[model samples]
Target: MSEKRRNRRIKNRNINQSEKSTISKRSKIIWIGIIVISVLLFSSLLSLQFLEHFIIVD
Candidate 1:
């Protein structure tokens, strides 16, 4: 009975550790995706402004 309890506790600990790692990884990926999307949006806006200026000059 004690051995079984020890095994169960170990299994639970491993599962918790795995869950924490995956959560951290998922958050990191989400942050990276947000940063990339914001950068792309900013660059596109800048390009649009430049295009407008060129059109006005022509």
Candidate 2:
């Protein structure tokens, strides 16, 4: 019985570790996506503003 319990505990630990790694990877991906999107939006906004300024000057 004790051996079975030990085996179950080891399995649970392995599962938990795997889950944590996946979770970390997912979070990293999400953060990278957010950063990329935000940067693109910021660049677009700046370009628009520059274009508007040029039009006004002309």
Candidate 3:
């Protein structure tokens, strides 16, 4: 009975580890998306200033 309990405990630990790994992977993807969006937004804001200056002169 004790041996069976030990095996079950190990199996549960492995399952928990796998779940944590999957969660981490998902979080990493989310962070990458956020970074890309932020870069695009900042670049557009920078270009808008240049466009405004040119438009006023023209």
Error of 3 at 10 (Å): 0.6
The better candidate by TM-score, 1 or 2, is 2
Instruction: Show pairs that collide, candidate 1.
Output: none
RMSD of 2: 0.7
For model 2, residues 1-58, the per-residue Cα lDDT tens digits are 9999999999999999999999999999999999999999999999999999999999
Q: What is the C-alpha RMSD of each candidate to the true structure, in Å?
A: 1.3, 0.7, 0.9
What lDDT tens digits, residue by residue, belong to model 3 across residues 12-53? 999999999999999999999999999999999989989999
TM agreement with the true structure for every prediction: 0.83, 0.93, 0.90
User: Which stretches in model 3 have alpha-carbon errors above 4 Å?
Assistant: none
Q: Model 2: clashing residue pairs?
A: none
lDDT of 1 by residue, 1-58 (tens): 9999999999999999999999999999999999999999999999999999999999
What lDDT score is found at residue 34 in candidate 2? Answer: 100
